[model samples]
Target chain A: MQIYRFEDKKPFMEKLEELLKSGFTSRQLEIYLPHPDHEIEELVEEYWPKSKLKFITLAGGLSGCSAGFAFTIFTSLDWPLITSGKPLVSIPPYIVIAFELTILFGALFSLGGFLLLSRLPSFKQIFHPEEYGNEFVIKILREET
Target chain B: MSHKDTGVVNQEVNAKSAAQVKDQMERDILAAIKKPKPVYWLGLLITITMTLIGAAAWAYQIKTGMGVAGIRNPVGWGVYITDFVFWVGIAHSGTLISAILFLFRARFRNRFNRSAEAMTVFAVMTAGLFPLIHLGRVWFFYWLFPYPTQRLLWVNFRSPLVWDVFAVSTYFTVSAIFWYIGLVPDIAILRRVRTGWQKLAYAFGSLGWKGTFKQWQHYNQIYKYLAALATPLVLSVHSVVSWDFAMGIIPGWHTTIFAPYFVAGAIFSGMAMVFTLVIPMRKFFRLEKYITVDDFEKAAKLLLFTGMIVGYAYIVEFCLAMYSGNPFERDQFIYRAVGDYAFTYWLMIACNVVTPLTLFVRKLRRNIKYLFIISFFVNIGMWLERFNIVVISLAHDFDPYAWGTYTPSIIEVAITVGSFGWFLTWFLLFSKTLPVLPITELKEEAE
Candidate 1:
């Protein structure tokens, strides 16, 4: 992993565009930044077009909605008690549970996706520059010829 | 080029230097976390003591039963429910500032969102305790959850209390996640700068973020989604809380207007709490440059807006009560204004409605002292507002035979003070331990 440091964003972005234009594969190069940069983000999107993050959140929401409804309905049926003489499968109050669960599961799953996709909890000793949080550093993983 | 044009271009160029802004932000924000002042420790000690008192009060209440806490036949909800709602209200400002304001691209929110979110997490923690305290058997609180039990009795899905169990818990989970997710980058920054134990702790918490573009991109996406998810919660949590009353048959509790009314009041109180916490926090941490007076002015304006909404809710509630020709609702509203609890009702009006009007004056809006004082009044007013709605309504409801006035016992008072102590303890500790300002967000805003 070869790391390059730039004092300003323009050169860093220029170098990023050069690498992308030079046909660097997504796996062969990675850009590290102190914060999100719009230009670099655009370049990354152009190079690596797909991100599975949103799907994770969507899947979690659907699962949560189903689980919320199932839990409420099953529990109500299990008890088999009449509440305010309302229907056994109450939708109005159940919607509250469904809404809460949707958010709860969506957030949890999004965090999970973040951890999984970002390859976090990396206890391995990887090359990380101290100024990575203070300055932009791009690392290029080149294959041996 | 003109001199002014050259000067403007130079300023823009200087601001575009990411290295300088990043370095300065790291130094400024990290300094608050690294340096431990004596006053912070003193504040922590005071809060710990108050928390212990609160714990002791709870222990006494537990041993003696719920009767010791001044909740009786008519006023069964009493101070515990009031504090619960008040703290929950206080929790809303964090989500409002962090999620809602972010969606709106409110730049000033960057300065204070971290602290406000932390406040939300802790305020919810404080609020969670009230239901347990209200429950006579705190140990059996799990019965609220719909677990497969031997008795086959599930929590009633039709009940607002059960909705509260889900709503408050979901709010807490989402708020904590949103707050922690926002802190990841900052935590990674801390891991870089700190030493030994602190570095190890931060490293573990930060999940080994390398500031890679991929990481930030994903982080940014998740943050947006989480913010969007939390926005509705800021409305729904309070609305569901309002339904805890609004769904009831009690005269004051049974009203359609309670949903939006409670939501507005929650934000109003929450904003006041932000001012209450941030004023001294910015001073104590010496973070004047980061949390500028401009931020305070913006927050004050938000306070004014929410306060007026709350004021409007109050007026509308009264008019609706009068116009409905429902003697029960009308009597409850009149009783609130003229009955035994009228002092509290009037005080609520003065604090929530009258005091915030001063913010309309530009000079007063910018005055930190005035803001602080008004915020304090607003906090008291919000608490009183909850009290007026909860206890007063119950105390004066139908069946004059069952109507009764109630007062909080010393134990309940102690617990209330302790809740504040517990909340402040977390805030003070957080100020010392983490970046009070979001360093990355601040850098982005600067750009």
Candidate 2:
């Protein structure tokens, strides 16, 4: 494994781009950043695919919307009692619940999705993980052929 | 010095400075968590003591009965309700700073977002308590949720109070998750720097973040998405809270404008609170280099902007009341200005309206000391604004016979004070335990 480290993002990105241009696939190169950088993220995205976390957020949001409405409607209809001379199934107020649930579930699922995608909470890594302080690192996993 | 050689030299110089700055950022932030001065302990002691007093008062109320609280008929909601709204309002600008400004790509947010998010989480936790405290039977709080009860009854879906349950709970959950997400990388840093038990604790807290490209890709996506989600969520929470009153048929409470008005006021009050907490924090932690006066000026501009919106709301409320020729609405507004709580009304106007106007002047807006002093007024004023809305409306309402005043009993006062203690205790602990500034976000500025 070839490990290249830089203290500056400019040099780091230049080195990363240089590797990408020299027939090094993203699969063979692992990048580590002390902080999330837009330029590096974009450069990585060029070789690697876009993150799939958005799908999880969308799915979670849709599910939450349906659940919110279904829960409110089903519960209201179960009793069949109405107050304030209003309709039995109130869509207006339920929309508020649905909207809130959309954000709530979307946020939570995004976090879960992030953890899952990132392979977080790894017991091994937690106890004994690789530590890099304030460096942009790119480790070449293997040379092609 | 040839041009090509000078360019190379500049690049080298820039790289060296960036490296130095990155190191400096980490060291400065980590140093804050290392030691506590006597004043830190003193502040902690006072807040803990206050929290205990508040808890003791709550215990007394639970034991003695709801009668111990001053809330009675005609004024079924008093300080407790005001506190609920106030604290919830206080939470808004945290999200505004952390989530909304983040979306706007306002870099200044980096200075305040971490502590602001912390404040958001803690404030919501504090606000969540008032509802349970307001409940005469606190144990039956579960009834607020739509659960499978033995009686087969569900909470009223049409009620604003029920909506409040969902809004506030979701606000709490989402803000908490967002806060934790922002902390993960910072926690990883702490885990690396600390020793023994501290490292172990931070290890668990960090969830074994490796700062890999893939991890950061997902992390950035979720952070952006959460900011988008929380922007609307924060606005909706206060609107839903406002509806708790607006949906009512009570003259003063029933108004369509309450939604936007309350939201603007929430942001306004929340901005003041950010100042309230952050100014002293910036001073104590000696974070002047990170949270600069320029950042304060930008935040002050936001404060001024929101304050004007709130002031417009105050005027528009009165104008609408008078224009409608509704005696109850007119009486409510008139009574608010000159009746039992007139002092609070004017105080709110002076604090929320007049105080913020001072910021329009460039010097005052840039003056951190002046901003800090007025934040107290805004905090008090915002609390009173909620008081005027909740109690004043219920006090006079439609009937002359029911016209009565409400004064918060000692128990209620103690609990109200205690809520501040509860919020501060968490914040004080947080300051010592966690990075008060987002170390990762600040590093982005180095490049």
- Looking at model 1, residue A7 earns an lDDT score of 72
lDDT (tens digit, per residue) of candidate 1 on A51-93:
6799999999889888999999998887789978899998989
Which residue runs does candidate 1 get wrong by more than 4 Å?
A125-133, A143-145, B1-17
Q: Candidate 2 chain B: worst 10 consecutive residues by lDDT? A: B1-10
Residue-level lDDT for B240 in candidate 2: 99
Clashing pairs in 2: none
Separate DockQ for every predicted complex = 0.64, 0.81
| Fnat per candidate | 0.70, 0.84
Docking class of 1: medium
* Native interface contact recovery, model 2: 0.84
Query: Tens-digit lDDT track for model 1 on B125-162?
Result: 99999999999888999999988888878899899999
Off by over 4 Å in 2: B1-17
Candidate with best lDDT: 2
How does chain A of candidate 1 score by TM-score against the true chain A? Answer: 0.89
User: How is the predicted docking of candidate 2 categorized under the CAPRI scheme?
Assistant: high
